[model samples]
Target: MGIIRKTFYTTVLTGASVFGYLGSTTTLISPLPQDDPFWRSRSFARYNVHHNACTQDICVKRIPLDKIRPELLQKEGDLVLEFCRGVWGGLGYKPQRAYLARKYQGPATASQLWTSEQLSKSTYERGTQITDHFEVVEKTPTDIVVRCGDTPRNPNPRDSDGLFVISAEVDKQRNEAVLALKSCFFNSGRKVEGIQGPTPGWMEEAHRWYTRLWMATGAWRVTR
Candidate 1:
């Protein structure tokens, strides 16, 4: 009787395990279903994007994300708003939400005020355009200057708010975070660390890639 009971328990356990495995596999291994609306819709379909999108990539040549935006991580080539999140309250962005949505989602249209600034984020990202490229210049060991976008000249530049060199410095660095900024005047009393690793999976992968980017090219932009 005891042997039979043990055998029955083992059989039940195995069956449960098999079912559990299959259930988990559906979410992880199963392809986007053919029946799913997106797969067949044709208008739009996308695979999972990295959840934690970074505008700042960390690299050997660059500073860490938390160092720049203590509370958030940014990507390598995102627009000004996302990248500036490393700044205090990120100072938000010069443009409104609708503007950012347009920029981030598809073809970006700049405000009339944005004309004086670099036209494309790529220009700033690759250090291609001399107007907004600052990573190459080192204003000081601590204070780095932005390139020639809008330097204290224009009351309101085309693409940005100010027309001068926005400055920043390494207020502090720790395992919790690496803190720095594009403008020191704004960061009078800010937290040096708050960024934390995202959850596992795409979220984590996104952060890792972001880290890779900044680790490579993040630097202080100085004036010539």
Candidate 2:
């Protein structure tokens, strides 16, 4: 009986120690820039630079806006606003809240901030130091193009030197729209810090996945 009690206590202590270690060292994903408020409070063990490249990932997903006409797609109202809201709100690991700045430099230029809570409870609450800039760089009756600028506060010190465009292509006869998100970026200069992620190949793949996910979410929001 004494031996059994000692073994049980030892096992319990071991389990407790393991759990405590995991709780202390586990790496949680902090909210990305442009996420919602639930993600505002989270911690990141390290910055993951999946793809710090000049290569491009073009994720094109087309949705038929049967109800809306080609002419209406160019205007800022229900369809346009909904699509913008979709881009602002959708696609995050956690629930997100997005805010767009009221002041615009030009007709379609604006800055947006996304804040979200960490999926897991975290003490850190800087809400991913990143800001997104967007612009309606090109607009026509048939096509409207939205450009997303490099997010600030990037963990990877490489810096983004590329173009990211999300364009809406309208088919007048079919009355359908094609949504395309192109992420083109190249890392410029050397790493300021000695730190970097392990796998460069995986980083590019992850980048593609993220951009694709973002495109898919936006497409689903507007079309569905």
Per residue, candidate 1 scores C-alpha lDDT tens digits across 1-224 of 99999999999999778556433322221122346332222111111121212122111222344445433333322323233222211112323333534443332322222331332222333222222212222233222234322322332222322111222333245332222222111111122233332133574344333333232222222110
Q: How well does candidate 2 score on lDDT at residue 29?
A: 28
Lowest summed lDDT across 10 adjacent residues in model 2 is found at 38-47
- As a TM-score, model 1 comes out at 0.20
State the lDDT at 71 in candidate 2: 52
Candidate No. with top TM-score: 2
1-224 per-residue lDDT for model 2 (tens digits): 99999999999999778555433432222112345221221111112133332344455554567744445465643453344344545663222233333222233332233333221111111232222443343333322344333443232334444444445556568756666555444444343343332236677676655655555455545652
Clashes of 1: 39
Q: Report backbone clashes per prediction.
A: 39, 19
- Listed in order, each prediction's TM-score against the native is 0.20, 0.44
lDDT of 1 at 105: 32
